[model samples]
Target: MGLSPSKRVDAALRRAPAFAAACDDAFDRCLADAQGAFRGVRLYQLADAAARLHASLRASVPLVRRWVPSPPPRARVDAALRAAGLEGEAELSRAQLGEFAAELFREAVLAGAAGIVGVGVAARAAPAVVGRVVAVYAAGAAAALYLSLG
Candidate 1:
């Protein structure tokens, strides 16, 4: 069987340092600037799907303007990630990252390329985004774990 959700989140937290650093460098102000578009788990999952791209400098989102596009639809994200073998994964190998990155960038470009970053800032902020999601996710998971144990 798969791990409990709490265990899974904790595991992700253990591997969260690098992504967290990226968040520190970019997401805080931008999250507010997104005007609630990037809040909570939506932001988290976007990063999860784009984990590979976020790590690379090519996808780094620089906060300059006040407006940001909305993230892509989520209905197909899980299925696509599963097909990519990335669903629920905390860490990814370089080869896997390349495959996922190309797919995500392609989709993001197709979805919205409003000159935000030559593709679209909305779906492209995973590197600048996931750390906050991890923090929020881990906090929620910890609460769930505590309540369950208590």
Candidate 2:
């Protein structure tokens, strides 16, 4: 095997600090879920963790945005949030957020810097959603993609 999931996470930590910090915080926030994502190395478990973490982040969006300097434009934020497929205030399941995040990352890449920067706020405001398990998810598969590449 090239590397275990834990090893991959260590590599990611070395590769990105903000990402790593978000991972670290996520670990502290939800130990079982974090373990599920980091140690289990199962996509299902990882996806579960991503959903919970996203929920945490979703719940705390307003608080996190306050800390971010000049948050992304409302239009872009709304557009991205819309991708989550929420009907009013209905909560999303892990699968739903994961699907949305995966697609969002790909679309963001095509959108260029603006799209990338739009999602960057998640990094600075990662916590309060608890260790940001998504970062620790691989530092989180879909959550990591959502935060890093969203």
Model 2 segments beyond 4 Å from truth?
A: 1-75, 87-89, 113-150
Model 1, residue 109: what's the lDDT? 34
Please provide, for model 1 over 1-150, each residue's C-alpha lDDT reduced to its tens digit, 9 standing for 90 to 100: 867543443344324444344444334333444565644223343454444334432333321011113333455444445656776665343344444433443344333322333322456667546555556655764454444323
In model 2, the clashing pairs are 25-131, 26-131, 26-132, 134-139, 135-139, 136-139, 137-140
Q: Which ten residues in a row have the lowest lDDT in candidate 1?
A: 59-68
lDDT of 2 by residue, 100-135 (tens): 333332233234322333354556654533344433
Residue 84 of model 2 has an lDDT of 52
RMSD of 2: 16.1
Instruction: Say which candidate scores most in TM-score.
Output: 1
lDDT score at residue 137, model 2, on the 0-100 scale: 36
The numbered model that scores best in lDDT is: 1
lDDT of each: 0.41, 0.38
